[model samples]
Target: MSDADAPLSATPRTRLRRMSQKGRGDRGALFEVLRAGLVCHLGALVDGCPMVVPTVYGFDTTHLFLHGSVASRSLTTDAEVCVTVTVVDGLVLARSVFEHGVNYRSAMVYGTPRRVVDAEEKLYGLRLLTEHVAPGQWDYTRAPNGRELAATALLALPLAEASVKTRSGPPDDGVGPDAALGLWAGELPLVATWQQPLTDPALPATVAVPAHVAARAGTRADRS
Candidate 1:
């Protein structure tokens, strides 16, 4: 099978013990979850203690990129880390409170991240991060200078060890004993959309909003 069509490896850390049916093994399914998320929680060991920090990230077919200050504890090279991204689609309200659950798509990525030191790759990684957060902002804004690049840390973690799990549709109790209860049960869908652009107050009145920024208004923030 092609790499994109290959099933995810069931490694010790990535195997789903519970609700295994919800686990997605296809790489395409994994990419779908990542594409729909804008932020990821990065977990790492800092000074013998665990730390999980939410940060913006960008990913390609082989690697996920994250950037921060050079001295940031969480960006240490060769450190084993776990990165997770989740997108909540809705709330499944069941007949009983115990059966109520969330409809979500989540992925966990495990790897030892390496610091990006090559000037060219570092710049490209930064571009990926910027464009992931704001599509047209990279070309619209000034490029990072030597001093700026020196102070910033860029990390590239391989996507080889990753797992995706998704849950959707109604609650499982619908066909069970709870179905006899005279109670309403359904899904409360949740959607996130972009509002109209808020121009910076510091900008001159003569300046107009960029077409790329203005176009995002009223658009759905989550692709899935």
Candidate 2:
């Protein structure tokens, strides 16, 4: 298969033991879930205990890039870690509370992330991160200087082992015995949109919003 059609490598740890049907082995599926999310929860063992930190991330075809303060314990650890990204699409309301569920797309990546030391790669990774969160802001804003780069820590985790899962549509109880209850059963779709840009009060009224930024207002922030 081509790289885009390649399957995700499944190790013992990356295997799904529960809800096996929802597990996706294709690399494209994993990329899709990650692309739709802006944040990821990094799970690692810190000082012999478990710690999960929420942070923004960026990725390319080969790896995921995470950046944070140089002092953060979560990024410093070179041990194996689990990174998760989840995007909730809607709520599945069923006739019975027990049958209620959520519509979501999620991915779990397993690897021992390494700290990026090369200056060129670090800067490139940072650019990818900035552009991922805000499409045009990277070019519009000033690039990080030498001192700013020194204070930041960047980690690169290979996208070799991962899994994706997604659930969507209406309630599952519609055709089951609960259907006799005759209660409401449907999906409440959830959508996230960007609102009007709030300008900095310090900026003079003469400064107008940039076209790239202004165009995003009132648009969907999340991809299905």
Candidate 3:
């Protein structure tokens, strides 16, 4: 079985302390959250300064892959990094403002990312990244050329040390004193859907939109 298919063990860094009730120890939860989200925020220390950068990411069974231009300062370093992906599901409105919260599914991964150097792996990583963002687009478009590959940098971070947390349902004050207040106390669902594809104006009239791209229109962006 692939690493992704295997279970995950919580590390010291990944263990949740504050909201232990929401923490998920299973590997499947981590993989599910990562697969549903499109973008990830990468936190790292660069030149003694802390930086968090938002970037596109992809994953296989064992590792998460991040890619950017070779000139990008964030991708060039060997420092340890924290990657997080979150999907907001709804807004929890309570009787009190302080009790309000957001319903979300999130995952945090910690590790020192290794820069990908193998030609074969690099290409494979790129393909995974592309398909993650837009399924079936990789096979439809031309593969990356040598010049493009040389300019790009890919980094792989192990998915071993990670934490997954999720919050759902209604406000927590349903049985509390705040429930006495005559205010709305429920969840306002938040959803994202893809709109119809807009074709390039410069494209030939005969060049039609591919089925895979066209089919995604009006579908949930976070669908697994």
Clashes of each: 0, 0, 1
Each candidate's lDDT (Cα)? 0.91, 0.90, 0.90
TM-score of each predicted structure versus truth: 0.97, 0.97, 0.96
Expressed as tens digits, the lDDT of each residue in 11-96 for candidate 3 is 68887889899987778889889888999999988778888899999998789999999998887446788999999999999899
lDDT of 1 by residue, 94-120 (tens): 999999999999999999998999999
Residue 60 error, candidate 2, Å: 0.3
Clashes of 3: 1
lDDT of 2 at 133: 79
Off by over 4 Å in 3: 1-7
Clashing pairs in 2: none
How far does residue 52 in candidate 2 sit from its true spot (Å)? Answer: 0.6
lDDT of 2 by residue, 94-209 (tens): 99999899999999998999899889999889998988878899899898999999999999999988888889888888889999987889999999999999999999999999
Off by over 4 Å in 1: 1-3
User: Whose lDDT is greatest here?
Assistant: 1
